[model samples]
Target: MAWNEPGGNNNDPWKNRGGRDQGPPDLDEVFKNILNKFGKFGGGKGGSSDGKGFGLGISLVVGLLVIVWFISGFYTIREAERGVVLRFGEFSHFVEPGLRWKPTFIDSVLPVDVQTVRSLPSSGSMLTEDENVVRVEMEVQYRILEPYKYSFSVTSPETSLSQAFDSAIRYVVGHSKMDDVLTSGREVARQNVREELQAILEPYDMGISIVDMNFKDARPPEEVKAAFDDAIAAQEDEQRFINEAEAYSREIEPRARGQVNRMAEEAQAYKEQSILKAQGEIARFEELLPQYQAAPKVTRSRIYLETLESVYANTSKILVDTKGSGNMLYLPLDKILERQNTSNAPSTNRRTLEGLRNQDPAAENGPQDTGIRSDRLRSGRN
Candidate 1:
């Protein structure tokens, strides 16, 4: 039956025992009743048991809250990261990679990647040392080295690094020539910028190390880009020409040296040959001197005959009989020369030809067959 039925007891679902107009049961009273049940174990009286129960309940709640806060502070650091711990908003220490815990409300942890290289780019139109404006772009790569300084040395390490990069790049570019920034000096400029950036950041101890700096792009303003391009091309061409000339010199120098060495060798050989030939001739003359001094006339005649033989050895010979009828008779020495083939044939032929040239007409007084005999025979016939 509904509690409000006329025959049944009227029970007010929303009323307490005082029955005035309570909206719901009082939470404090409900809690006290529940704790009193626990307090029964202590065997306390009415008010003392209730008070003891409330105190135990409050202690349990505080202990549970403390445990939850401690557990919440536990964190994990990755392999590539470092945890920068702070005690009451002040730098404390660095935590390595692993599961770690800290006082939840007292200590805070900031995880930073120390192994990863971060890059920042700086680019702008800057004036060079040569009073020329060039658009330059550069990249700065860095890694967190000291997490404490990176977190506390400055409000923002990345922002500070970026500003430092700008400063360094501008300083380097301002001191360098436009041609160098855009040409063969790019590497030098990149190294200088990296050094300058490191120097600038060292004073602040931003806890970041400059890994490298790259010269990304360097060019003149668009208004003058064409002219700069032409100049760069001309410079490249000049370098190419120089390299080619050097290569040519390298190639041709060896060949020229070889020729010079060969000529020197040939000259030395010729000099040796001439010296030996002169010595041989001097020895021969010395040997002949004693023979000439022993028998003067015979030696002289022998020398003359040898000289004649030597002279005739190389010439063709023909015997001419000029004493016959005022006409000359010629002997065919060429045919005889063709028939003779001996090692000493030239010397024999030379001696024989010389003897024949010197011979007198056969028995000059015995046979006087001249033109007068021809006249006597003609008169007899008449």
Candidate 2:
């Protein structure tokens, strides 16, 4: 039975002693009771004292937390770095070097090394314009210009930049010749790669500024390395040969021209000498012709005698006069000549004959007697 039922518990002392208050407390009454206790404990002097102490403790904790948070947000940037501030996941502004701060949890900051030159190396085997494969190694230097773009515009700026660099290198390599890639074309390749990378980054809004691109090494593959080396050697040899030829030409050309000039001068001198000699001979003949016409017989005889004298000037002779004694005088001239023979026989004989001719009044008869004596001597007559 229920507790209020009286049939079984009429004699129960607990039930009969007090009149029944209620089955359960009403919601309003319970609420009012709690409110009254709360008001009584909260409104009194003791209660007010406890409430103020608790509020003070809470404020102290909150202040400490705020100080700690502020200290955490107060970061200093170095001279080489730039700070990027993001509020509520949006770019706010860039902070310069030195002390900087942002609200905790409400704003975020990223420090980028803007002034630092970053280097990235890229390498790959690429096909050139000549359809030859070559390995190209290069280095790219860059720096951040816009901190906001660097932090938010791309998910990973370095990775994206590297990808763009690879694409640019490939594009440039594809358009270049293998010989150029291995030789003087490296500078061109670097410029083209830098330009292409800049173009790609511009569209992606990347904040990277390309400082320069340098080609470290570029060469043909190992399979063709020997052939390329041989080709280079051959080219060097060819250049050496060309230089040698040029030098030879440079040294010999002037000498040849000088020789030609000397020969021409000699020929000209010969022509002048021949003309002067011919004119002298003609003048001499013209001068002699007038004398010859004035005294023909005497001039002719003189000319004949001069001609004979000139002809016999270098010869040895023996003379005898058979008409005066009517006897041939055997002079034994060959024996006398043998006895007088010396290194200066011709000069001695010329002097002796000249002295005799100067002393004799009929010197012209000497040669006539010489011829007759020679004829008698040949006939062995005395």
Candidate 3:
């Protein structure tokens, strides 16, 4: 069952043809046998042909390795990216976005995204100008403008930019009041931080352009939040009140102007009416003057009589003549006016006039000649 048993044929599994005990095969002889097989390909018996065949095999291996290295050097850049070439671990040049190649070991390419916007946010509780602490959060958006500077100008551009942002934000916060940082002054503080950050990064040339800076949030500490909210509310109310007042002023001003215009128009109309009335009066007097010049006595008598008739029509008192005897009748005007005002009846006034006309004058006064001028009045009329 077992080979090399004592009573067995003493057979070796490795085929020991010498029938002698051997430890193991020698590595030198095995390699020589392999070389002999390869030497047969040269189809020669001398050592010179074997050496040439070995050299050819070594050259083929080297060529394959060189081709692999050359192919590995070729890379592609994306549409939004640029490649920064480094030669022997130093900055060489920049490459545009496309398929490109370089010496495998002699040059390297570092692709940097140039078209993407990067954001950096910085937030912390900072001391304000009034010695109050306020938590401020801000974000800076930037883009790589120069790939070379972004890659090699500093050890780490992003770290340096972050530090610059911190420094600028702190400086701005330190110079601003707490109320302003928390409220109406956030925009001003944001602008100042952006300007100061740009200034700080100017010397380093980090190849970053600040597209925008936003004041994300600003607030007081938790302990004083309620109080600040109240203050802000009061400020808002004050603004609302001011706006309302302005709106009311705008609404009322037009109405007041309209009223003033209407009053002015009314006054103008009254003035025009008075001027027209005066002109008409002047025209009437001018016409009357000519008539008076034509016949002075007749016009004078007619004017006197017209004046008397107008006066008598307005008065309640009347003068009556007794045709049979030289007697004058006196009518009580006060009693008649009192009766007329109390009754306001035309019949009462007529009855009073008729009773006075039919009264017996002889019984009341016996022949009282009251300077009778009836004949002169009649003569003037004629």
Candidate 4:
């Protein structure tokens, strides 16, 4: 019965065996009892109740330990990272990003960031094909491609890459002249070096892909800095002169072509005009051939008169051959036209006044129709 039960006092754990109402069990007695129960688990003669409670405690502790060990194996990988799993210090499979689990102390995960681009620079004074020294600086940009290969292919991939760059650059520079290294040959040298580097690295399978390789600097030695500067300036000046010549050629060539085309067009028009004029003349001659055969002298005279008319139609000067006079009279018809126009009004008024006077008895008798007579004289003179 329990201690609070109506008739059972032996169920009280704090009650003394002396049947006294003790405050609590003695410390020595509690310790002894626990030791006796643990001893009974190995076949000691302890109380059955003590052994059962101790057995349940051991089972609960072991279960809690198992749960802790399983949860401890979980790990997380980031978005850009690639994880390589190793089982017992040997290569296993790969794992992706996010929370993952591996057996503790058995499988290990190595996370390598494959997305980040890394750069390595190699620069030094190297000998050229011409036995000239030139300083060159270059950078290689790369990223990890295969995590397992990168981890296990070579002892140290970055160091190997640096050595490879040095070797390739030296090889290319050795085959190139100093001027090329410093100027137009820089691009060729860069290409050659990259090609050579790739060739050297392919057998090793370093698992690094070279994104780009750049020749950052290619220059002469500092000892000859002034000379190199002058050389570079002259090269620039030569390029500038060539560019200017090209620009001038581009600007002036079209104008010359246009002028040539214009001259050709004008010549073509002149040629067509001459051909048409010749055709018309041929037609005219063919028609006039029959006329000449019908009346020789009359056709000849008619042709002469037609020629005179064509010539005189274009002339503004009038030449008058006076009768029996050795000297010919010359008059500018344009000037005569202007003078006649100016004096016409005054001449008409004078003529009218003269007629009035003649009608009156004060003027001497004159021929009738004097205006008509004057007009006839003017026409005869013309």
In terms of TM-score, which candidate is strongest?
4
Collision count for each candidate, in order: 0, 1, 0, 0
Deviation in Å, model 3, residue 355 alpha carbon: 36
Instruction: Evaluate residue 22 in candidate 2 and report its C-alpha lDDT on the 0 to 100 scale.
Output: 31
TM-score of 2: 0.51
lDDT of 4 by residue, 249-306 (tens): 9999999999999999999999999999999999999999999999876687567545
Worst lDDT run of 10 residues, candidate 4, spans 360-369
User: Model 4: runs farther than 4 Å from truth?
Assistant: 1-55, 288-313, 317-382
lDDT of 2 by residue, 1-382 (tens): 6655867655444543457633444799775554444444545343333544545555666899999998888888899998888899887888889987778898888888988899999999999998999999999999888888887788998899889889999999999899878865678788888888888888998877888888899889998899998887887798899999999999999999999999999999999999999999999889999998898766765665565555555555565544566666554444565677566566655565565456443444534445653565566454
TM-scores, all candidates, are: 0.62, 0.51, 0.61, 0.65
Ranking by TM-score: 4, 1, 3, 2
Q: Candidate 1 lDDT, tens digit per residue, 142-260?
A: 88888778888998887888888888888999999988999999999999988888889889988888787778888888898898899999999999999999999999999999999
Error of 3 at 218 (Å): 1.5
Show the colliding residue pairs in model 3: none
Q: How far out, in Å, is residue 23 in model 3? A: 12
Candidate 3 lDDT over 199-283, as tens digits, reads 9999998888999999999989999999999999998899999999999999999999999999999999999999999999899
